[model samples]
Target: MTEDNGGWIVFQRRFDGSTDFYRNWTAYTNGFGDIDAEFYLGNQIIFEITKDENVELRVDLVDKTGESGYAKYSYFSISGPEDFYRLYVNGYSGNAGDSLMYHSGQRFTTFDEDNDLLASNNCAEMYHGAWWYQSCHHSNLNGEYGNDDYGSGPNWYHWRGHYYALNSTRMMIRVRRY
Candidate 1:
């Protein structure tokens, strides 16, 4: 990741939704200075930026084949001459149901209900509701350890991950100097 004129940071993410190969994406900032891009996908990549102090960027992926796989998400935090931005990347597996949360600092912006939110003004909120709820393993008892509410109703809270349990959650935070 590189910084442009002012304090803009640019990063990229590989776009290979249909294929199996790991594609490599690139990001570049403009001369004016600003966070050019945070997360890039599809033909037209999207960028999320914020001026706040606390915000988050949420991402959800859907796998139709039911095959277990993993993907990588990357971001670059750029700043001015005195301070430099950092690159943060994490690996997320493509399961039936998986949710990944990233905290882009309090100064960043947050995503809204729609997945097509903008990150330039504040933090952009990107949600994969269709994919997130459909892919994971759900139970009525919220996927609790010894709860008998298994399969009783829709398990909207329970999520399968390393922690294991109904409260299993994932979050990422990216700090950039502005």
Candidate 2:
């Protein structure tokens, strides 16, 4: 888990996600500056979106050079815990149904809906982050886990490392800051 100078758990589940969490977030979404500026390659990225948060992470694809919300139709499989309440503490509040939605199509309620209410809906980079449900596991999948490769070399996140291809989307990660 990535912690702030205050020693609070700011990010986790993956190092790359905790490392570049805010940099890639605002860089692609252009949400906040002071919050985004706080994060360095090794520092934790902190943002104040709500008093009670349990955000869900979204992994998708986008152009190498583009803004947020540019996902392709290609299917990919990701694993996560099916139960979020397991991670909850006192006052840790959020939707109870998000754990199941994380494995299927989006809820389409505005930008982010039932699935991951706070999902970035973009493709920034790998191991992208969001306030996932307390139970979303990284490997023990509860739903579909897609496996497709558009590039060669090594394997990661179930896809070959091909970040961008013309208008075609490249594999990337994004966090849904609540």
Candidate 3:
């Protein structure tokens, strides 16, 4: 839960294909995986923590070639289950490009729950992971580990294109001191 000597609480992490990110809604909601390894910090807890406070989101990415980049949002939050955990984010500033902004205002989707805007396909099921998807996503860190194929692996589309699977990804958040 600690990184770079900061109090950033990691919400999700992906690296080698050691853990399966392609899980059901309950698993994603209640949380799963080892904290020292790949995991999602659970949507319910995320909503509880950020609902009443100002939080900042940071997404770090390392591409297959070892190049790295990051994207930070000044404000971030999400609505609860009744609204499908709708995403809300703004004020982007970083080197990774604004991939997550495209997913802002979208709803979380899973193989068992299709809440994305895409009418024909369940983005989570098609992409092999769960996520806040809007007509799919520009960033899908929960996808199959190391797959690298289109819609099949963790990706920050703006940083390396959709087909280029990233080497690693970390999504972290912290309460804004101000």
Task: Name the runs in model 1 displaced over 4 angstroms.
Answer: 1-48, 64-84, 87-178
lDDT of 2: 0.23
Q: What does candidate 2's lDDT look like per residue over 15-116, in tens digits?
A: 112222223322322322232322222111222221133433332222225332312212222322232111211221122112223324321111121234
**TM-score attained by model 3:** 0.95
Candidate 3 residue runs with Cα over 4 Å from true position? 1-5
Q: List candidate 2 stretches off by more than 4 Å.
A: 1-34, 38-62, 70-100, 103-178
Q: Count backbone overlaps in model 1.
A: 20
The per-residue C-alpha lDDT of model 3 at residue 160 equals 86
Cα lDDT tens digits, model 3, 20-58, are: 999998988888999998888899999998899999998
lDDT of 1 by residue, 1-178 (tens): 1211233222222122222111111111221112232232221221234323322233222222332232223332223212212122234333323233231111111122212223332112111111111112221211222222432221223243323222211112334333
- TM-score to true structure, per model: 0.22, 0.19, 0.95
Top-TM-score candidate index: 3
lDDT of 1 at 54: 29
TM-score order of candidates, top first: 3, 1, 2
